[model samples]
Target: MTAIEIRNLSKSFGAVRAVDDVSFTVEAGTVTGYLGPNGAGKTTTLRSLLGLVTPDSGEALVNGRRYASLDHPLNEVGAVLEATSFHPGRTARDHLRIMTTAAGLPASRPDEALDQVGLADAARKRVGGFSLGMRQRLALAGALLGQPKIFILDEPANGLDPAGIQWLRGFLRHLAHDTGAAVLVSSHVLAEVEQTVDNVVIIAKGRLVRQGTLAELTGNGGGAVRVKTKDDFAPALRAAGAEVEEVEPGLLRVKGLDAEEIGRLALDQRVLLTEVTHERSDLQSVFLELTAEGERA
Candidate 1:
């Protein structure tokens, strides 16, 4: 079943259309990435889903019902939309207790949640004294306090270091695998999402550009093809029906053609070959191609 369903969701502010005809579903036991550049309406769309902003038209349903109809919102739909939305003087533990208490969850869960996010050592520290990463972890702990069935995190990696990003990725993956919670993580970092997400919904200029499994969006992802040759056989490689493009100065990325075929073709053309590989598109290139191609058309 879909954990979250957005049906023809659209939102507008005056003459500006923030979200336009966008629709996608997040499934149980999976991480679905919500991707778009800044001002691409990702945050606006997410806010509408959580009832923070009423959409101009269309519907957003969490766990098969509107968010407003839910009895305990925190238990049903947990969110970390803003990392710093806490009282500066409050300790992390106090901040979380207040939040979970408002949602009717046991205030005790706050300490456990903070521990889960690796903040147990700093629980007594005032929130204002926390670093950006600490505050982000606190925000995540707040979102996890009720153990909700689904999570909606807008830029969860914001202010996080590389280690923190990696930690969050693994944490989200475990949440889906261990607890069977659906996760909707929004980010502009395609490379990071490519490492963690199972499905992706890409938006550009308030419109859907691509939505599918990472493999499907990246063209069957059968490992990757890497080709290296010192031979000036670009024309010959092209004529042989190998999908090739310049990666750096001398490297050409080839898809759909294997190393063996490339070597044989170069050999037949009397071209010296240094290397051959099948490593195809990286997530960044795949994302760039998808987004750029959409804009070009």
Candidate 2:
């Protein structure tokens, strides 16, 4: 199912365009990473989808309907757009209980949500004493109170330690792949995003630059190959219409061809192959290349 869709979405402040003709979709049963450098209109696009910002043009739809038009928004969508605020004096469980009351959810939901986010042991602790990571979990617990099918979280790993980050990666995958939810996460952590998400949508200078699976975006889908051979194959590979880059003394990064094709070429050229590996494009490198223009803008 197409859980979230932004079609030609554009938004702007008084003098600056925040999003420009951006379009993308998040399907159910997958995690989609929403990524961009700073001031690249990522937040604006997300805000538009959540109905938090009024766009200049285009539509942001959740389940084919605007957020405001949903019959039961809370039952369909859960969001953590920014840093969550808490009353320092209130305990974690109490905070969620208040949300449940406001949302007309069951009283037991608070405990259930707390447990789901691994906060049951700290349920009675005051918010004032909670660490940043713990507070992040508390915010997530509140979002879970509704048991929604779609989640929209911005920088969800901001305060997590290495272990917490790893746990979150697994948790999100479980939500999307196992529980059949659509998870859209906006974050600057390319490494984690590369490891966690099933698909990616990248924007720059208020425009959509790329959207695809990691393999697709990284050109690892039969697009690049790394080969090591005794013979100097750079000239021959280039003549064969491959873009060859000698990354090191004996290592060649070949594009416009796959490993199988490269191996065949080596055989034809009588080059003894020591290695023929398909190279996955690095997310960090791709991100930098795509957004370099936006960074200067």
Q: How close is candidate 1 to the true structure, as a TM-score?
A: 0.84
Top model number, lDDT:
2
Q: State the lDDT of candidate 2 residue by residue for 1-297, as single tens digits.
A: 589999999998988988999999999999999998778898888889989898899999999999988767778998876655899999999998888887788899999999999999999999999998998898888878899999998888889899988988998998899999999999876886788899999888898888899878787443678888768899989999999899998989898878888888888999888998877658888887777755665
Q: How many times do residue backbones clash in model 1?
A: 9
What TM-score does structure 2 among the candidates reach? 0.90
lDDT of each: 0.85, 0.87
Q: Which lDDT tens digits does candidate 1 get at residues 52-165?
A: 999888899998888988888888888998787888999999998888778888768988998999999999999989988999999999888888989999999999999999
Evaluated with TM-score, which candidate comes out highest?
Answer: 2
Q: TM-score for every candidate vs. truth?
A: 0.84, 0.90
Question: Per the 3 Å backbone cut-off, how many clashing residue pairs does candidate 2 have?
Answer: 0
Cα-lDDT of candidate 2: 0.87
In angstroms, give how far residue 283 of model 2 lies from its true place.
1.3
